[model samples]
Target: IDGGLLSPEAVAADPCPHGMTRELCGLLCGDDDPAVTVDPDRPVGFALALDCQLAGDSPELLDDAQLLDVVEGAERMERWASALRTRMLAVFADRHPPGSSAPPPGADSGAAAPVGRWLPDQVALTLRVSLEEARCMLAGAVRFAHVLPATLAEWEAGRIDERKADAIAHATSVLTDEVAREVEARVLPGAAAAPRRLLQDRLRRTVARVDPQGAARRHERAKADRRMSISRSDDGMASLWLSAAAEQTEASWRSVDRLARSLG
Candidate 1:
C-alpha cells in the first residue's frame, strides 16, 4: 500500500485510534502528505498515515499507537488554534480600533469585520500536527476567542452578573447568527480593548467587590496551605501527591459543583 492513496474504505477497514471515522481522518490529513491526493474517496488513509507520522512512529498510523497520537494531536491542535486566534485578533485590532463608534462604509451596516486568516503552508509546517488538524484548531480558536472575550470582559468589569456571564459564555460557543448579531449590537460597539494592566485591575476590582472578605480569606488560605509529598508504590511506580487544606478543598469542591450544575 502506498498508504497515501488508500481509500476511506481502506481506512474504515483498518480504523485509526479509538476507531475514528474516515470523515474525521480526512479532516485530520488535508493535503500535506506527499503520497496523498485530495480525492474524498481516498482521503482517510492519507489522514491515518499522517497521524501515524505525527505520533512519532516510522510506520504510518499504527493501530496500537493511535490513542497516544490522537491525544498529542488534540493538544497540538488546541495550542496552535489558540496561537492562531491571538495572532488574528492582533491583526484585527491593528486594522480596526477597538472602540470605533462609526460603522464601516459598506453594504452590511451592522456586521463584524472578518476576523480570521487562511493558514499558509509555511505556517502549517511550524504546527506539530497535519495541516487539516491545524485548520480545525484554528477554526475552534477563532470561535472561542472572538465570542467569549467580550462577555468575559464584561464579567470582569462587574457590568454583567456571573449568571449572565455564564449564559454569554455558553451561548457564544453555540450561537451562530442571531447571537452574533446581538453581540455586535450590544457588546461590539464601543468595545475598546483594554491594556493588560487595566484588564487585570478590572478583574481584581470586580472579584473583590463580588466578595471582599471571601477573596481575602481564600488568598490567605491558599498562601498557608502549600505542601508536597512523594511516595513509591509496591508496583515500582512513583507517585506525587500535592494537597491543600480543608478550607481550600471545600472551596474547590463547591466551585466544581457549581460549574457542573451550570454545564448541566
Candidate 2:
C-alpha cells in the first residue's frame, strides 16, 4: 500500500516487519495521540503507535475540524513551552559567563569547589532539548524579545540554551506594541467598548441609512451610556450610577430609549 493512502487501521498495524524506532513512530503519528505515550520503558511501542496514526490511509482521519482543534491547541502549548524555555535560559546565562571558569561572587564557599561547581545537572528539565539545542532556542527567544544584547551576555555565561532563546523571541514578536494596540482596539472599553462593536457599527449605519436624524440622536445616546457608570454590589448585582447632571441624565434616558426602540 502507498504510504500516503493507508487506512487508520492499516497504519496501526506494524507496517515495517523489520524493526522501527520511537522517533520514526512519532513522525508517523503527527503529534496529537494521547494514547501514544513516550518514555524510556515503552519508547518502541509509543513510536509504533505514532507511526500508525501518521501513516493511516486517509489524511481525513487527522484533518477533520476536531483534528484541527487538536493541532491548534498543541501549537499553543508548544509556543508557551518554548517561551518558558527561553526565559529559563536567560536567567542561567546571566549567572554564568562564557570562557571564564570562575563561579559567581557568592558561589564560592569555605575552601575550593570544582571548576564548574555551580552547574546544576538539571537546571530546567521541562526543556526536552539538550543544553546545546536549548541555548540556540534561547538565542532566538532573546532576539525576539528585543533584549538580544543582554540575553547574549547571559548565553555566553553557559546558563541558557538555544530552544529557550528562540521561544522568548517568538513570544516577544507576537506581543509587539502594534499587536497590543490591535488587541486593545478590539477588546478594550475606551473607544470600541462593546463585545459586538462590529454589529453595533452595522446597526448604526443601517439606522442612519433609514433615518439620518434618528441615527444622530442614537449616536448621542450611545455616548451618554458610555459616560454613565455601572457599579456592582458585593453580591454581584450591578447598579447603573447615572450622572446627577440634568442634561446628562436626559441624554442617558434618550440613549436608553433609542436602544430599546432599536431592539424592538
Cα miss at 10, model 1 (Å)? Answer: 24
lDDT of 2 at 141: 44
Query: Please, what are the lDDT tens digits per residue for candidate 2 over residues 70-144?
Result: 443343334444445556655665545444355434555554344244333233244555656655554554353
Q: What lDDT score is found at residue 134 in candidate 1?
A: 64
TM-score on alpha carbons, each prediction: 0.24, 0.25
Which residue pairs collide in model 1, if any?
52-61
Clashes of each: 1, 34
lDDT of 1 at 223: 71
Candidate 2 total steric clashes: 34
Give the per-residue Cα lDDT of candidate 1 at 249.
64
Considering every candidate listed, which one attains the maximal TM-score?
2
Off by over 4 Å in 1: 1-61, 99-264
The regions of model 2 sitting more than 4 angstroms off are 1-63, 97-264
